[model samples]
Target: MTTTSVRARFLGDGRIDFERATLGPVANGQVRVRVDVCALCGSDKRLLRSGSPVVPGHEIAGTVVDVGADVTVPVGTRGIVYIPVFCGTCRRCAAGRTNQCLHLRELIGWQRDGGFAEHVDVPARCLLPVPDDVPLDTAVLGLDTVGTAAHALRLWQRTQPDGVDRALVIGAGPLGLGVVAVAGAFGVGEVDAFDPHEGRLATAVDLGARAAGDLAAENQYDLVVEVSGAAAARETAQRVVAPGGAVIALGESDEPYTMPATPRWRRTDCYTVRSFYFPTSEVEANWDLLRDHGAALRDRLTVPVTLAELPDAFARFVAGDYFKPCIVSEDAP
Candidate 1:
């Protein structure tokens, strides 16, 4: 039998070229989803800078159109694709840290063909069914933006038994705003957000965090979450972290920097500093977080664009025109 054909896009230097590709039979334990929407992520900027040679959209939501043997989710189920592809038998996977699997293969958006097309195949184990009430567009951000923030917050909460006194999130981008949105949900008493961009800072304030122009607080915050991936932000996190406070660094820096900068440390300071990744097991809870916040939050936090406008949308993203750009199918509501 002839294979079905689907439209796919390949990335170039800030440009996208379209192609028609054949969709093969679904492999065992896999599902083919007709993508409804794919939210462009903060990390997608890395792809943009590198000329994003591969199909790249990790924050994906769609309807399952086909499924192979052993897959229980029926066809036509609305769902979101979990981006991290892990070896399920690894020790980390056993401990529920699939994101840290010993043999990490491809991340769906970066290393594999992702949801920048009419259809994409995903491992059934990586698929999470979207609840009926959750919009596919909002569901897209649940996979990465909110998921990662919730993961970071969960880790940060482990260090604060008495609850956080003041939580500061650096960068005021999607993830940063996410940190502000959910910090109080995680027992943070007061939340503050810092960003250089006034527009983003205002968005942060809208998300229930007090906005700050700079990270000049001297040892005032009990928790500081750094999401900017900028050298200066990391340096600022070090400066503002109170003694016994913790810093969760989620962003990646382009240049190498000396860890344990002597200037930012004091002899008696005891703090925990660590990097965080998405939690594959937390999909349901992450979806719940978005659902609980509802459309008022989702609408202010995200905007939808058609896939054809993705390339230009990305350009506008870099120019600071949109906060969260979600690419949706023409038929998506």
Candidate 2:
């Protein structure tokens, strides 16, 4: 069966074009989803600037409407699309580290056609089933916002077995706000956040983080999460972290991550934990986190718009007029 759907295409130099795409039958080992909500991410800016070869909306939540041969996931099952297409047979995958799969090559939005359309075909294994009680919009945050934040904190716990006393988050964007929202639940104490944009920083404060007084202060926070891809933010994270503390690098950048050979940098002894998206093993736990904090986050971060309004939504997103703009399907419940 073939389906025609309206999807967004990114043309280079900050342009978006909407076109009707003819999607062929679901390939074997795949499932076709009717996208209910696809949230804009900061990472999508890179694709918007450079233009993507495939459709580009990664933080996705939808309902499975069609299944390929041999797939057990029933139609009408709600799920969030896991971006990393991991090979299930790999040792890392066998250990439930799907994000760290040894054979990971393509991310759904980056390398393959993603959820900027009404329907998207993805690997059956990449569908994370949503609980019946969770709303699709709230469940979508499990992909990048709350999911990644929780994963980073979980990994940081390994470095500091006791607990995080004071946590600092640089960049109060969607993900940074996510960390702030879940920090207390993760046992982090006295969370503080910084962002150059006052509006975003205020949002972080609304999410339970204190406004950072000074970015220049050193050796203050026990855990510093760097969520902005800016080089300066990375430097700030390295500087503010205490000697025995850990810096969780969750940001992505095209610019090289540099460790300056300053005397302070040379003497400090700290663990730098870099984390990717959450592993499938953590999905159940993440759902709990979402259930506790997801609604507030959705209210603060997401501004829902129709599929036809996607280009305008992205325009506002680029202008910082919207925090996280979501393309919502008309039929979404």
Candidate 3:
């Protein structure tokens, strides 16, 4: 087939440009999806700030419209596309850790074209089928937001076999929100969410977690998930985790985190801290979670807006006007 021309949006330097671009033909073992919905992530904000030329979306859910040779799923299958483009022969891919694949050629939103367009072409291996009952936006959230949280939770589980007593999530953003929601859904003993925004805390509370600015009890929480990359938040997470408790840091920050000098509070031997990133299997499980709690998750999503409104909407989103905003295709359900 000839090169496909599509209208797509490029975001960089806090600005968005929409124009007609010619997309290359789908390669072998690739598929083209008609994007139904794509959501903004914290990483998107960072990339926008950098003014780098990227398609700028990793959380994508859409319907397959075309496929290259040897594709498994037929055209018209609806699903969420995995972000990492990895070499299947790599050891990491063999172990189901595609995110860590040494031969990663591209990350859908970061290094390659993503879903902020009429159509996105991706490897057929990247497709994870979403049940028809699940909403497209919810499916997208399952891949990035909930999946990241799930990965962290799995790390915590590996550390503390008994499970969390009291859990603290430090951040009120989309990832923080996902942590709180998943904790609630999984029936954690007590989940407390901390954030600067009252609105976000309110939403956290609505999702079955107690909202607070900080943990009152020192070294009380068995699990502390640091979703906010702020140095202060990272320090707080370490301080509040009980001895031998698990601290999963999912946030990314450019600055280095320094340990306190004090002996009492600076006990490095007291806890376990692990960094996490999303894995493919976790995202598949997240889809199941989304299926069960789709309505609740849907409630947290900002009202969908058309692609034309994304620039202003993105500006507003950065200003804290929206928590998680979805870009809706005109034909999206």
**TM-score for each of the candidates:** 0.92, 0.98, 0.92
**Per-residue lDDT of candidate 2, residues 166-199 (tens digit):** 8999999999999999988777989999999999
Candidate 1 structure quality by residue, lDDT tens digits, 65-184: 898888998988998888778889988999888888889878897888788887888999888888888888777777657888888888777787677768888898888877787777
Clashes of each: 0, 0, 1
Better structure of 1 and 2 per TM-score: 2
Off by over 4 Å in 2: none
With a 3 Å backbone cut-off (N, CA, C), the pairs that clash in candidate 2 are none
Instruction: Kindly state the number of residue pairs that clash in model 2.
Output: 0
**Backbone-clash count (model 1):** 0
The lDDT leader among the candidates is 2
Q: List the residue pairs that clash in candidate 3.
A: 13-51
| CA lDDT, candidate 3, residue 276 | 46
lDDT of 3 at 15: 71
lDDT of 3 by residue, 1-333 (tens): 544544445555687778777766678999988889988777788777775465778889999888888898898899898888878878888898877888977888889888777788899988888887787877787876788777777766666666665788888788888888787555468888888888888888888788754465577677888888899888888788787777777878888766678785666455555544677756657767777766687777556877788888788898998887888898776
Residue 243 lDDT, candidate 1, scale 0-100 = 81
